[model samples]
Target: MLLFITIGALCLLLTIVGDLVKLLQLSKLFRCISGSACSDELQQQLKEARVKVERVRQSSNATSHYTYTVKLMRAENELKAIQTKLRNESNMQNLKGASVELVVGYLLKGVLSLVLFIITLRNRYTPVFLFNENINFEPLEGLLSFPTGVHNAISVPFWALSCNSAFRLLFNAIKGK
Candidate 1:
């Protein structure tokens, strides 16, 4: 049980790390989009916001933290402005490529999760050829099953988002929106 819990925790940690990496890549993508859209002002806002966010991170007191929260909100608003500007001005080809990449990533995640689910389910139903018949570890199935379930849960939203993005991009390409 401990081993399974440890594995589950490790899996969650890995997922979080993966999401952070995705966010970092997205920030870089935003920078590129802003540059191409001639959003110098928005870029400056982001830089300032980042600095303020860092300052917020450094502060320990609640009163100062509240002020930092305001700064963070302002920063988020600026980010939304930047996104709007980029959406209006970014190159269609670049946007389409990015959308395609995102779709592929999401679909791949969904496919892998499906595969894991099938494998775990099969293991649960079938005999363990490698293990002795006298030895039982039915509890271990919970470990495999739980992780597969979690993966499936996480993958579904990504798949949906990817599909939605891809369809929007397709429509935009067709309509020049």
Candidate 2:
């Protein structure tokens, strides 16, 4: 019972924190904290590419019909490619914060899931709630018990899921959404 309560509380806490992070829009701070090395490098490359394109355009003979020379075309393509890369980098940076937090949240959730699995496996025969009278709903009993074989039981995973659902509902209600 103590283990169940502890696990329920932890699951509730994790769900609440995950919700808060999304609701508060703290992803930008996370992205900033994650650094801007990729964007910075792309910007530098964009500048160099622009310079090469400009130099190629200027060095070509103005009076000649060969204006679209191979060098100039190649430089222009490189410049355009770099510009595209920089644009993509900026876009990715905008999403990075949210993605980073999502990954961390997933990792924490995974650890919690493992703990639940271990707990359930250890207490396979122990019913979370014992019925005073026998209830012969085999399918429902099996589902409620899940990893545990105990009849009329609520397993750790089920309990944790309930805790998460309850907390999320409360959180959303408090958030007015």
Candidate 3:
């Protein structure tokens, strides 16, 4: 059970970390785009978006889990508008790099999941929940095996998001908006 809980927590932590990393990357992308041959209005908007992301990162200190959660939520909400604006402004020719990044991110996640699954299988498909005790049994093994399923299930949405992100980038680029 402890092992299950640990895996669950790890999944949640990874998801949050992924979002934070994306926020920072998007912020940097906005800054870079702003410096390109875009309109002054677009440049200003991009800078504002980057500033909002920076503020979220600063406020979402990991000192307390609750504080981090709240701030992440705040960051996500704030980013929605920025995302929409970027979607409006995206061009396929310009976002080829972003599309590549999306693919790389998905592949990395896939590799990580595969490695974890391999590790679990090597450990006899049982997680070491407690240090002093062996947590192996038919019933317990059945129960413990659920963590991998849970982890996989949890990762599905992130994979979908990766697909959506790549598709949106392509679609917007093709639309020439």
Candidate 4:
């Protein structure tokens, strides 16, 4: 249906916008980290730590500089991995995409219901011609209103479940389990 398609398109657009915002935030965070103004004492501490580390490396009598360099690189990689894990956990807790998708799905469902209502009106008996046996019309109208509410009610839980399942799968794949 045109209504459902339109709704899906709009939801896709919203998802893109949300992703862009996230990317922007990440960029901003990176810039902040690179541009931060550290106190002189902290800078001094870092310098001293670097010097101490270098001294320790030199005293260790490692066979080659290559070994020290490789070890340093591996430590950096581990630190990055830990930071990435923390960020991912925080993002999951926020459920940013799930919230956005839930809203979009509900809106789409409402549109679908409205379109159905319009179609029903176009084909139904004239409003003015109330036959004696048309006592069911009021109840039918009530029934017609149910789809929109049902759609909204179902979307949040559906999205939540989907996201949870998807994340679990992703986690398993990442862990090679």
Each candidate's root-mean-square deviation in Å? 20.0, 7.2, 22.7, 13.6
Model 3 lDDT, residue 117, Cα? 52
Candidate closest to the true structure, highest lDDT: 2
Residue-level lDDT tens digits of model 2 in 31-146: 67665787788788888988988888787775454665877888888989988887786677778866877876777777766776677567665656655446666657778777
TM value for model 3: 0.33
TM-score of predicted structure 2: 0.46
Query: Worst 10-residue stretch by lDDT in candidate 1?
Result: 151-160
Best by TM-score: 2
Residue 139's lDDT within candidate 1 is 57
- Please give the CA lDDT of all the candidate structures: 0.49, 0.73, 0.51, 0.45
Q: 1-177 in candidate 1: lDDT tens per residue?
A: 332233343333333443444555654565465454456665676677667666665664655767878866776676677667656654554675466556655665565456534544444433222334565546553443342343112222233333345644665576565
Candidate 4 per-residue lDDT, tens place, 1-177, comes to: 343334344334433443444544544354344423443344555455556556556755655677777766655555555556555644653464445545555565566446444544443322212235434445444333332333112232233233345645765576577
- Pull out the clashing pairs in model 4: none
TM, every model: 0.27, 0.46, 0.33, 0.26
Error of 1 at 137 (Å): 15
- The clash number for model 1 is 0
